[model samples]
Target: MKAVGFHEHGPLDNYDLLDVPTPEVGDGEVLVDVKASALNYMDLFAVRELDNYVPQYPFWGGGDVAGVVTECGDDVTAWAEGDRVVAVPFLSCGDCRFCVRGQEMLCEDFTMMGEMRRGGHAEYVAMPEENLIPIPDDADFVTAAAVPVAGGTAWRALVPRAKVQSTEDVLIVGATGGVGTYAVQICKNVLNVDTLYATTSSQEKAEFLRDLGADHVIDYTEERFDEAIWKLTDKQGVDVCYNNVGGDTWVQSMRTLRWGGRLVTSGATVGPNPETEIRQIFMRQLDIVGSSGANSYELAELYDYVWSGDVEPVIDDTFPIEEYMTAFERMDNRGLYGKIVLTQE
Candidate 1:
């Protein structure tokens, strides 16, 4: 099988196709013919910073995948061959206390596909039956692939982590990436947020955010987002701030929140550690909450929205598996407003 992986990774320039043996189907697992996969910032880290993360050579890294089952394990009854499915990215040890309670994201042994294990950036990838969810026949593979990671993650950030209220005004710092696009949509379409403010460096993305239901879009390149938010809210600050950009924007994100507002975070795409005034948290009574991978509950609800078209995937571009470097280049340089999908064919 030809996969978009590398024997060894030093940088994105070093990653290319690898002639790897096909993965075998295990009990309760299914072999999927990958149709489409989506790119994320983590892909940049996987190929560059995550040294020795894979157990072997020829590792293909991808977390968001949509495909069709070509073969199913003998014990698998819930799914069969030719079933259209989307991979739920995260794998958890089912016996853990968190997993038993359905909070698998908190599992002690939680790992993400393509980051800690073999991912679906290949022609064929094997997934556990439980981690695969059926998609309707009419659902586009590229769009479905874009949904699993971004949609569920954005839902986790806004819905559960931030506990966003429908009547509260919210802000999404860095609203142009894969998760940010979905976060804006989920805030409006799913959560019915009263008002939405999102930050982006480009005016193109700022307009995109507005069209996607953000009440206000802040172009942070021209002015600081914290100042913009302060002015926009008349110094009242927003009720919630969905901040994944970390370090560079952490203090500003905290400053944009209202007194008693919540700041929910998942990733620090920018530098992870940044200095901040500790007084802000104590003085304003802010809630700084951190969340990780999306569990089954969030994934299921997010997929339902995807199936219904209430929350749609924002596909900026699609590249063949062979051209993943180009797709990733667009993501790494912040040249995309939404997911850039990779076609396995």
Candidate 2:
């Protein structure tokens, strides 16, 4: 099997395709012939081994994948060979306390694909049968591959983490990236949020956000988006603010929220250590919630929306497995409107 990996995590220069042994299926696991996989900021961080986080050398590093099952291990009755599927990125011990309560994302053994274990960056990968979610026959493999991490994550942040309400006015920061595109659609089509505000760096990206159902798209590059959002809501800020871009934006993101409003976060792409305004947080009775990627239950529900076309995956570009370096380059430099996918064929 050919896979995109690093001999030892260091920098982008260390990443490339290497001839590696295909993963074998284990009991309750399935061997998948990977068709397409999506890249994320986590890929860049993984390749760089930021803070010495890579668990081992020659690490496989892809999270979002859509593929066909070529073989199924014993005890796997729900899936079989030739089944088109997408797996939840996070692997958790199913018997744990959190898993029993349907909060597998909080499991003590929680680990993401491409981080602590072999991921779907290759022609073949193996995953637990429980993690597999069926992809509709008509769905594009590349698009389906883009869902597990980005879309599932958006579902987690909105439905469980933030508990976003239908009557709430929501604001999504970085509203043109992979998660942002899905976030906008989830808010509009699924959550029934009528007034959606988004922030993007370019006018073109802003237009894309509008097409995704953002009611107001502010150009963050030109002005402070908090002020724009403040005025857009007639002095009453949004009921919920979804912020993943950490940095200076953290403190400002709170200003976009109304009194007692909630701010939900998933990732910190810009930088993690953002100075907080504790006084404003206390005075406004704000809730700052941190959420990780979705659990299997959330992924299942999210995929229902995907199959229904309510939540769609937006692909920025597709690169062959061998050309993953180019894909990584695109992800490193911002400005993409959606996901960057890698194809095995």
Candidate 3:
């Protein structure tokens, strides 16, 4: 099987395209003939071995996969050959307390598929049967592959973790990035929020964010985004703020939240260190919620939304599987509006 992998943690150029032996299905697993895979920012982070979450050498990096099942193991009865599916990226121990409660993302043994183990950046991948979700016959592999990680994470952050409601005002920081693009669409179309504010460093992205359903787009390069939000909201802050960009924008996100408002975060792209305003938390009774990947139930909900056209994944570009390095370079430069997909040929 041909796959893209890295023997050492470093730059994107360190990735190598080589032929390795195909993976085998275990008793409770299924072998998938990967049609397409999507890249997440975590893929870049994993390549660099940042934040102590290091993968062993020869690590394959990709998280979102959509493909057809080629073979099923003895214990895998729910699916069979030729079944089209998308795998949920969150891998968890079924016996864990969090997993038992349908919160698999919070399980003590929780890990991402591409980050902790061999992922779908290959011709074939063997995954546990439990992680596979059926994809509609009408959906293409590229669209299906775009759903698992970015869409799932957005669903978890805005819908469940933050509980964004129809009439509430929401602010999505970094609204043009992979997760941010999904968040913008889902918040507007799925949740039907009253007002949506999106912040971006680029004017070109500000226009794109508006097309993605952001009611107000602020160019963070021109002015302080918090002040813009305050002005737009008439001195009142947003009901909720999505803080995916941690260090670079966390303080501004904190300032943009109304009293008693919630700030939900999933990733720390700018580095996690943020000045803590202890008084703001206590005096305003604000809620700061940290979220990870979505659970099975949330992923299922996200799938339904995608199928129904309530939310759609934006693809900046698609590359052949062997061009993994080029894909990573595009991602590292922030040169995309949404998820970058790699297709198996």
Q: Across residues 178-234, which tens digit of lDDT does each residue of candidate 1 receive?
A: 889899999999999988999998887787889999999989889999999999899
Best by lDDT: 2
Tell me the tens digit of each residue's lDDT in model 2 across 77-188. 9898999999788999978998888778889788889877878999998999988888888887997899888888889999988999888999999989888998999999
Provide the overall lDDT of each model, using Cα atoms, as 2-decimal numbers.
0.87, 0.89, 0.88
- Name the better of 2 and 3 by lDDT: 2
Q: How many steric overlaps does candidate 3 have?
A: 0
Residue 174 displacement (Å), model 2: 0.5
Give candidate 3's root-mean-square deviation (CA, Å): 1.3
RMSD of 1: 1.2
For model 1, the local distance difference test gives 0.87
